[model samples]
Target: MHILVDRITEKTGLDPEKVEPAVGIMLNFIAKNSTREEVETLLEAFPAAEGFLAIDEATENKGLFGGLASKMNASVGVLAALNEMTTLGLTVEDIQKVAKETVEYTREKAGPEFTDEIVARVPGLAEIT
Candidate 1:
């Protein structure tokens, strides 16, 4: 909480004392299931000390965080795809060789969403495995 307040205060030119309690309460709330006092404290719009930490802790437990997870996976996939092409010298012409085999595999294992998601994330890799 202190670290966050210091950083935020330094950046925003606000007093660290003003935000520390709020951030601490927010963090506590995030760590717990939460209560009314915390909610009331947060409604005041004071960016609390533990806001980022609490969010990190809360989100750490949720596996199906759909948007954030998808975005993170998409970023990784895109980087990998680019790396495969650039570092491995996978050419535009090689795309043809990969296309047919991928379609066959997709047809064989149709239910898994991972295949479709990876394809979408990696752009031209849709027709590759």
Candidate 2:
């Protein structure tokens, strides 16, 4: 997790504290939308990943009004993660840079073949990178 946080920080100039939760949101988003094999590969490459895989339902659904009345949901998976990242004060360009750097880091850690396989399984990931 630190590795990912560091990589994101290095690539995006985001604070480590903010990067931590941003990456967690992305990992949780991926785990929700990806296949078991896809998630398992990432977990194997990044053991600390499991800690971030669970989405907090309370936080996930909370809205401006902090209740169902104002609860407008972001699109699921990477889009949702991207939306959350924006709340952390990142621009779309920063998100794209972060996404590309993340994939590059994963490729270095887990090999291109494995990383590519994982990316192929996640919807809209290609668009982001």
Q: TM per model?
A: 0.26, 0.73
| Error at 62, model 1, angstroms | 30
Candidate 2 C-alpha lDDT tens digits along 15-129: 7766666666666656666678877877898777776555333256332233332233323445556777677677788777767776777688768998787677677777887
lDDT of 1 at 21: 37
**Which stretches of candidate 2 lie above 4 Å from their native place?**
54-59, 62-76
All predictions: root-mean-square deviation over Cα? 20.4, 4.3
Worst 10 residues of 2 by lDDT: 63-72
Model 1 lDDT tens row, 11-119: 5454444344333322332223224554344334333423544643443323223234234544443333333332223344432233333333333443245334434
lDDT of 1 at 16: 46
Candidates in order have lDDT scores of: 0.38, 0.66
In model 2, the number of clashes is 0
Per-residue error at 2 for model 1, in Å? Answer: 56
Number of the predicted model whose TM-score against the real structure is largest: 2
